[model samples]
Target: MKNVIVRGYDIPAKTMVIANIWAIMRDPGFWKDPEVFWPERFEDSDLQYKGHDFHYIPFLSGRRICPGMNLALPDGMKPEDVASSEAIGLLFHLKTPLQLKATPVF
Candidate 1:
């Protein structure tokens, strides 16, 4: 059901087409006044990123869909908020060395 033949040509199976998601979502052929930002576009509509609906595929669809996508997406908490639990594991490893001068109190 994935492959489709058109004009004696095959689109192939499991092909990675470099499609422009921005343009596709704004195309007038499929949507009316598509350039507008309408969150209600999918209101009561079957169009979804659950795989079959090719129009919108955010985390993708089918078995390859992102498993942790339903985390609800947050803006992230400050380091001070979770100081005990949070840890920096980045790759770039950019930091400035600090110098300290301390005196012991009696």
Candidate 2:
């Protein structure tokens, strides 16, 4: 997730590569007001979850993408079936936004 500025389409011999995804995701140079939740940051970006662009990798790419992507279940029984039936219940639920409080405690 390091920001390696390449002048040309080539990798330099002495380039520094950082492996901190969290820090890169919050870098102001790449993201405006990185602390805020702005989906618009990706509104006009060409990055995709499938490694089309090396910038963003919300879901890790390659053979180690995700277990769920390669998982197999019965036709009638989907993964959600096992998930809801288990202690975890539903992974996500949708609700309309009423009102948000911006305290800025930090």
Best by lDDT: 1
Q: On residues 1-106, what C-alpha lDDT tens digit does candidate 2 reach at each position?
A: 4435566545556766567877777788886787886545665866564556756443456775655443345456543544332233365433421233234446
Residue runs of model 2 more than 4 Å from their true location after superposition = 1-18, 58-106
- Separate clash counts for every candidate: 0, 0
Evaluate model 1: give its lDDT: 0.57
**For residues 1-106, could you state the per-residue lDDT of candidate 1 as single tens digits?**
3797868878887876686866776778887777676645665767555547675544456676767444332245443443233335764332432223344556
Worst 10 residues of 2 by lDDT: 93-102
Model 2's TM-score against the true structure: 0.35
Task: Tell me the TM-score of each prediction against the true structure.
Answer: 0.38, 0.35
